[model samples]
Target chain A: MRSSFVSFTLNGEEKELLIAPGQRLVDVLREQCGAMGTRNGCGQGGCGACTVHVDAVPMLSCLVLAELAEGCDILTIEGAARDRTLHALQEAFVAEAATQCGFCTAGMIMAAKALLDRDPAPQREAVVEALSGNVCRCTGYEPIIAAVLAAAAMLARLPAAAA
Target chain B: MTRLRGRGISAVNYPTGMNLGGDPSQALIHATTTGNFVVTLSSVDLGQGLRTIMTQIAAEVLGVPPESVIIDTADTDTGPHCMGTFASRATHRIGNAIIMAATEARNALLDVAGEELEVAAADLETDGDGRIAVKGVPGKSISVLDAALAAHFKYGRTISGRGIYLKPRSYPDFETGAMDPDSCQAHACTIAEVEVDTETGEVRVLKLTSAYEIGRALNPMMVEQQIVGGSWMGMSHALYETTEPYYPDRAHGPVDFAEYLMPGPADIPQYDAVILERPSASGPFGAKGIGEMTANSPIPAIANAIFDACGVRIDELPITPEKLLRALDAAAVAPRR
Candidate 1:
């Protein structure tokens, strides 16, 4: 495997790392960066547990090669919180009780966050579409939908806050 | 409450005279091979909220807050032996054992409290926050932590409880393959309305309304999520999702999010969820499971909806456009009933 040096902005901090060819971005994030919050339920990328924002757009980290994501803006679940406070979506998830084992939580939140970032006032259908990729075995979708809608409402009030 | 009893089949039918000590304290403690709490039988959560429910039951029994309880499902060796995740029995069976064990521990603490407070055990109650209160006395109270401390100091015993539960066997008859063997039964009804394209045979689910009788919803928010997730899974299974098999090894089917055709926001219709709360006779706080039921109704409901929209009945799951076209073509030649 050819080791290539890759640099990217993760969460907010810029970091440089060596990545082997064919290395999944999910593996690099989990194994290299120690971000266990981004889970890999189905390595094939059918499940959205490994979803992360690449340049502010929700993309499946499992399918993306680490080399391809170099120099791109990346955001993982670990970065969703600012300082000690959790993102609005995370708090909404807790309030709505949308998490069970919490494996899919990070990806689900990221996907919803991306949707809300792009459209601060997403309709119910838009929220559902944005999260369609992420698969959660728990909280059927009602609480998740409720959480996304609630988070959007909360985020709408805070114009100065960064999503 | 109605009790249903049946004889169980065993290769070696042990006589009823076997020395089986029946003690509430002993019967309640569920211990795995590792001797820690074995509250859930399943490894895969599938979003039924069993972990939270188990924790709540354990804390309630042990006289602690729901947050104070911790759940570990990391390894099968260290925890109790489980049957793996399926059929939504975690909350019903494991929660019961945890509650039983916790109740035993609470009673042990109350035994000490009975002496210190000079009150009968029946006169004391534990509140939602695990605070012990004397009946008919508004201000008099004791925290569960203080009770445990006092009990340890006075009796030289720790405040803890454990329980293990095995449901009575109920299997299918040999002559007729009928199984009422499930420990618990959950029922749900779903109605779907869809719009179908006559030319392409594409069917879009317009709206889905589902109502379920889940005994009781311990956490309403959690229950809603469970239903919604299950509904989406069912929708995917019914209309779009599939795992294509290749003989020697299964290739990466739906390898990426773009290729995997799950119901997007435009695809998923409006959802109207109705929760029917009926306390089960045997469950903790009258709670029954609601994890897998959402997947059960979608196939039939969507198929029924397809017939409603267009005069076609596609039987197989994931009624994709290609499959629907074939069904539509076949229907054209077949005699109209």
Candidate 2:
């Protein structure tokens, strides 16, 4: 397999790295970037544990090749939190106890964050639909759904705080 | 008291109460078990709310906040040997041990606090936040932290507690398969109404109503969420979900996400959760395990619901549209008077 140099913005930091032809985007993020938050539950993209945002859209990192991520801004669970402060979704997840094993938390948080970012005021059905892809074996969908709604409410009040 | 939704009857029973005695009780107060506060448990939290439930148990016993109670998972070196997380025993068995340990720790703390504050242990109370106060002496009181610190310095040791609980010796007979394998068993009833397209043979779950008998709900919101999520996974297992064969000659089944046909955003139905919090005498705070119980009911419930709607009974799982159509055809061709 031929190796290629790939350049991408990871967690808001720009970086260039060498990758093999068969190296998946998930491997690059975990191995090269040292982002262990992007878990690989199922390598075939069946589970959404390895989901990440590529150019502002949620994409399965396991399916994307390292070469394909070239020049794209990739946002992962590490990026979701700034400094030490957690994202609203991550905070809600902890408060609501939405995370159990926490294996799927990063992916679930990312998926829900993507939905909430696009539409801050999503209906319960829409929230469920948005999180339908991410599978959480624990907490069921209730805490997760509640966390998303709560996160949305928190985000909605952020402007008020700023004012 | 908060009323439980759906089937509210307490059907599942444990012969012995949750307090499997470690030592003799003193003055009718719950005997605080010693050397068992920080128990090493074997159960794995496969996303179930075992940790929270265990925390609740410890908090209730120690008279502290759930947040203040720290539970470390079973690791080989630091923690005591425990059954690795599986079979929903974490919250039941391990939780009981935590409660016992915390109770002992609380007793020891109260003993020291009683001396420092010049009050009877019974006269003192620990608040939800673990703040200790005399019954009427508002100004004179100490916190659990203070008590623990005092106990540590005075006794020349840490005030932390530890516990280890083993499964009962007289448990269900494994050879006959008659014994209940679980420390506690959960019962659930799910009503899954689906809409199946006769033309394409695609079955869509329209609405799912799930009622589970979880001994007691330490957290009602978390319980409801577990049921709803499990219901979706169950629906996927029954209808759309399939694992492909590893080898090519094995004849490919649902190998990937596309072929597996798991319920996607378009697939999930409306969910109505009914959490039955019938406190099991043996559970910590009467809470039975709901982790795997909710998953067991949806497949049968959906199949039964489909039969109720279309007058067809499909015993096999994942009752695909193709299977339904075939069943429909076979029924149509059967001789009729």
Candidate 3:
């Protein structure tokens, strides 16, 4: 087994850590970097509870190797807030009460954030498609979808600089 | 192109708490000198928002804002005894206990405030804004923070309360086999609309609509979320998920979420719910159990819908396409009028 020091930017902070060759990025973020918001549901890529953004693209952290994330900017749910203020998506989720049991909430919100970042004015169908990979067993996805749509509306109204 | 569509309905009722033995839950409530109340419980919040709802219950009873209540559901070793969070019991058992404990703590606070204001405890009432004032004269008031401090430093009385709610077990008569088993019952009626393709034997659940007699919805938003999640689980159990594809054999079973087929966001149907509030006599704020029952009605309703569409009764679990196709083939050969 080969292990090397991998340098990457996590939640806007530059970090370099030793990683096992087969160590999944999810383990590095959670076990090493102390990012507990990323949950491991099935370990396989099936359940998207470990979803994170790798250079603005939503990828299951459980499937991506830590080595592959070297030099890439990683964003987890902990980074979703700015200056202790909830992101528009986070606020919308709270207002809509989209979270239940909160196990998959961080992943669901991360997936939604990716969708909103790509297409700020996504329709209902698009929102559903984006979150198709994330499995929430506590399972109230309707309110979650509504919350994403609401967040999009909220974001669209924000000043260009704030958005 | 021409898929057969059918609708089926199922009505069900579930008990609020466990019926086996004495199901009990305890709460410890204490007023802090800072004017906030802390509720410590052992019941786990498995995302059903028990912490939030318990806080609401305590705040309502203590005559303070919901923010003034802090719920600490620590591990069992440190907290009091609870029957755990199952059988839809958290809200009913825990809510009742919190109300009891909050009331006791509130009385203690009022007692301290009454002495400070030179009035009897009966003459004092909380204004729901953290102030205890004389009933006739609103100006004669003292903050709860002040009273809490006085009670601790001057009176040397710890403003603390403890509560426990126990459901007495009923033993069945050996001769009659009759017993009242549960504290209360919650009811739901679900209607499922599904489409079936004869060739593929694929069932697509289009919509799941239901009306639940929830006793009372302490928080309607959380209730709706639970219903949505539970209904999806029921749908998965009906048409998608399977632990044993080779029923009697243990050769090839799904080991992960990919192998196990659960419904994703794409499969979510149009869910509509109508909440009917008929407060139960024993429930907390009239809230009966809705967590477990939310997943109950949808299962039978979906099964019945598959039968209605293709006239094939899937007695086994997860009315799979292979089974439905076999039944459809058998039905085609018989052509019963």
Highest TM-score against the true fold, candidate:
3
Per-model DockQ: 0.47, 0.44, 0.76
- Model 2 interface CAPRI class: acceptable
User: How well does candidate 2 match the true structure in TM-score terms?
Assistant: 0.79
Highest-DockQ candidate: 3
Model 2, residue A149: what's the lDDT?
95
**lDDT of the structure predicted as candidate 3:** 0.89
**Models ranked on DockQ:** 3, 1, 2
Chain A superposition TM-score, candidate 2: 0.95
Each model's lDDT comes to 0.70, 0.70, 0.89
Cα RMSD, each candidate: 8.9, 6.9, 1.7
Best by lDDT: 3
Q: Fraction of true inter-chain Cα contacts (below 8 Å) kept per model?
A: 0.56, 0.46, 0.82
Candidate 1 residues lying further than 4 Å off, grouped into runs, are: A1-9, A14-24, A41-48, A54-60, A63-73, A97-102, A123-146, A159-163, B1-44, B118-120, B152-154, B171-180, B243-260
- The i-RMS of candidate 2 is 3.6
**Which portions of model 2 miss their true places by more than 4 Å?**
A1-7, A16-22, A67-71, A83-85, A91-100, A112-163, B1-40, B76-78, B118-122, B158-167, B171-185, B243-249, B255-259, B335-337
TM, every model:
0.79, 0.79, 0.96
Candidate 3 lDDT, B1-337, residue by residue in tens: 4599999999998888887878889999998878889899999888888998998899889988888889998889999898999999999999999989998998998899989999999898888888889998999999988998999899999888898999988899999999888899999999999999998888899999999998999999888888888898889888888866764566667666677788888888999988999999999999998999988899899889988887888888788889888998999899768
Write one digit per residue (lDDT tens) for candidate 1, span B99-138.
Answer: 7667776777676666667788778887757577797784
Ten-residue segment with the worst summed lDDT in candidate 3 chain B?
Answer: B247-256
